[model samples]
Target chain A: MPDATEGSATRREELLAIAAGLFAEKGFKNTTVRDIADASGILSGSLYHHFDSKESMVDEILRTFQEELFGQYDAILASDAGPLDQLEQAVVVSFEAIDKHRDEVAIFQNEAAHLLTFERFGYLAERNEQSRDVWLTLLRNGIEAGVLRDDLDVELTYRFIRDTVWVAVSWYRPGGRRTHTEIARQYLSILLEGIHCA
Target chain B: MPDATEGSATRREELLAIAAGLFAEKGFKNTTVRDIADASGILSGSLYHHFDSKESMVDEILRTFQEELFGQYDAILASDAGPLDQLEQAVVVSFEAIDKHRDEVAIFQNEAAHLLTFERFGYLAERNEQSRDVWLTLLRNGIEAGVLRDDLDVELTYRFIRDTVWVAVSWYRPGGRRTHTEIARQYLSILLEGIHCA
Candidate 1:
C-alpha cells in the first residue's frame, strides 16, 4: 500500500494531467476551475484543495515542461559530440518532447503570449531567448568546424528551424500515421542535405 | 481633376487598408468598427458608409489578395519554364506576396480558423487546398524530371514548405535589413542544397 504522502502526490499528477488537457483544448482564458473540475469529475473545492487557481495549475504545467526540455538542450550542448551530431540530437529530443508532452507543448504554443502579460510567467520569454541561443550556438559550432556551409545565415536558418519545428504542433497528432522520430529524421535530412538529387 | 468614381475607388482602397491593419494586429474578434473608424479619423457611421460591416471589409480584403496571389501562381504553373525554375519562381512570388500584402497575409494566418466557422469564409479552406495542389504539382514535376530526389515525401515536404514560407511573415519586416528577394534566395538555396558543406 502506498503511504498517504505518495497517494496524494499521484492524485496531484492526475489532476494536473486532466487540467492540461482542458487547457490545451480550450484557450487558457476560456478555461476555468469549474471546467477543470467538471472534466475531472470532481468538485471545484476539491481542485482548489490542490491548486490555488487555474493560473497556478498552468504555471506548474509550463514550468515543468520547459525545465525538462531546456535541461536536455543543456546536456546536449555539454556533451562531447560533434556539432552536427549535437544538432541532430537536439532535433530528435524536441520531437520526443512533442510526443510525450503533447498537451504541454500545445499549451505553450497557443497560450504563452497571454500568460507572459503577468509577471509570474516572464520566464516564457526567457525560454524563447534560451531556445534561440541554443540553436545559434549549434549552428555556429558547425560552421566553425566547416561541417556546415560557412555562408549559411545562422539567424535566418534559426528562424526556419524554429518555425518549422514548433508550428508543427498545430497539425501533429500524437498517434498520427508518421511517428515523431520519423518526422525528425526527415526534417534533419532536408536541413543537412538539399532536396535536389545530387 | 480625377473622376468621382476614381476618387471614391482610391478612398475605398485606403479604408480597406486601414481595416486590414487593425484586423491583423487586434484580431478579427477583438477589433470593432469604432476602432477602425477611429483609426481612419472618421466616425463609425462614416465607416459604415464605405463598407457594410467589418465582415464585408475582411471579405473584400482577403478575396482581392487571394485572387491576385493565386492568379500569379496560376500564371507561373502555366509558364514554359522548367519544373525546377517554376518551383523557384513560385517561392519567389510567395515571398513577394508577403512583402507586398503583409497585413492580408497576417489576417489570413491568424483569423482563418475563426472566420471559417462562419459559412462565408469557406473559400479560404478551398484556397488552402488549391495552394497544396500547386505545391504538389511543382514538387512532382521536379521529381519526374529527375531534378529533385525521388525519395522525397511530397506531403511532408509540402507542409515544411508551407509552414516555413507563411510563418516567416511573423518576423518579416517590409523594409528591414533583408529584402524579401534576398530572404527568398537564402531559403531556396538552403532548401535546394541543404546547409551542410559538401
Candidate 2:
C-alpha cells in the first residue's frame, strides 16, 4: 500500500487549495466549512477530518503563502545584488507572485486585517513587520550605496510600493490583456524613471 | 422660519452623512438602515421621509461626491496649467478631497464595485471611465509635451498613481501623523524622482 501519511498530506493540500479558492471568491466571513466541502466535492465531515475549522484552513492557506513569499524576499535580501537591483527584483518577484498565486494574494489582501484580530493569527502581524523590514532594508541599503535618494523617506516609500503592488491583486486578472511581465516592466518604468516627459 | 424644502434637503444631507460613516466603518452590506436610523436618533419612518430607501441614500451620497470631485477634475482639464502641473494639481486636489471627505472616499473605495453592478448605480462605471480618461490624458499630454519619459506606459502609470493615492483611504486618518499635503508631497517626490539615489 502507498504511504498513508504522504497520501493524507497531499489530500490536505488539495483541500486547502479548494478552501482558499472559495474564501477568495466569497469573502472569508461569508464562507463556511459546508461551502468549502461542497466546492471540494467532499462531505463536511471529510473536510473536518482534514481541518478542524475553516479558520484553521484559511490560517494554513495564508501562513503557507506568506512563508513562501517571505522566503523569496529573504533570499533576495541575502543575495549579492546591489540595493537598487534588489528592490527591482523584489518588485518583479512580487508581481510574479500576484500572477502565480493571485487567489492567495487576493485572500490575504481582503481578509488579512480581519484575520489578524484573532490571537491565533498573530503571525500576520509578524509577516507585516517582516515585509516592512525587507523594504526598509532595501531602501536603506540603496541610500547607503548612494543609488537611491538620500532624502527619501524609507517608510513612505515602502508603503507606497507595498500598497501599489498588492492592490493590483484586486483587478489583476491573469491570462487577460497584460502579461505579468509586461505589467511589472511598466510599473518598474514609472517607478524608476518617473513619468514626466523629458 | 426655515424654508421647509431647504430644511428637508439639509436633513437629507445629514442623514446621508450618518449613513456614509456607518457604511465606511461596517461596510455597506453589513450596515442596516435601522442601524443608520438608530445612530441618527430617528425612527426608520422619519428617515424614510428624507430618503425613499437605503439604496437611494447611498446613491445620493456617492453621486454627490463624484459630481463634485469630477467637476474639479473637469476644471483642471480646462485649466491653463501644463500637463505636469495639471497632474500635480490633480494629485493635490485628490489628497485634499480625501482629507475633507474621508468617509465618502472610504465608502466609495469599499463599496463602489458592489454598488456599480446595480442598474441605479451605472454612473459608478462611468465615473471610473472618466477617472481613467483624466489620468491618461494628463499622462499622454506629459509625454507629448516632452516632459515625461516617452517610454512610459500611460495606462500602468495611471494605475500606479490611482492605486497608491486611493488605497490610502484604508489607513489614512484625517488628523494622523502626516498631513495629507505632506503625504502627497512625499508621494509626488517618489513618483517623480523615484527612490533611486541620483
Chain A TM-score by candidate, in order:
0.92, 0.92
Off by over 4 Å in 1: A1-19, A22-58, A113-120, B1-12, B32-34, B42-53
Best by lDDT: 1
Could you tell me every candidate's TM-score relative to the true structure? 0.87, 0.88
RMSD of 1: 3.3
What RMSD does each model have against the real structure?
A: 3.3, 3.1
DockQ of 1: 0.59
List residue ranges in candidate 2 displaced over 4 A: A1-11, A30-38, A41-50, B1-9, B32-38, B42-53
Query: Candidate 2, after superposition: displacement of residue A99 in Å?
Result: 1.0
Docking class of 1: medium
Q: How high is the lDDT of residue A82 in model 2?
A: 86
Q: Which 10-residue window in model 2 chain A sums to the lowest lDDT?
A: A1-10
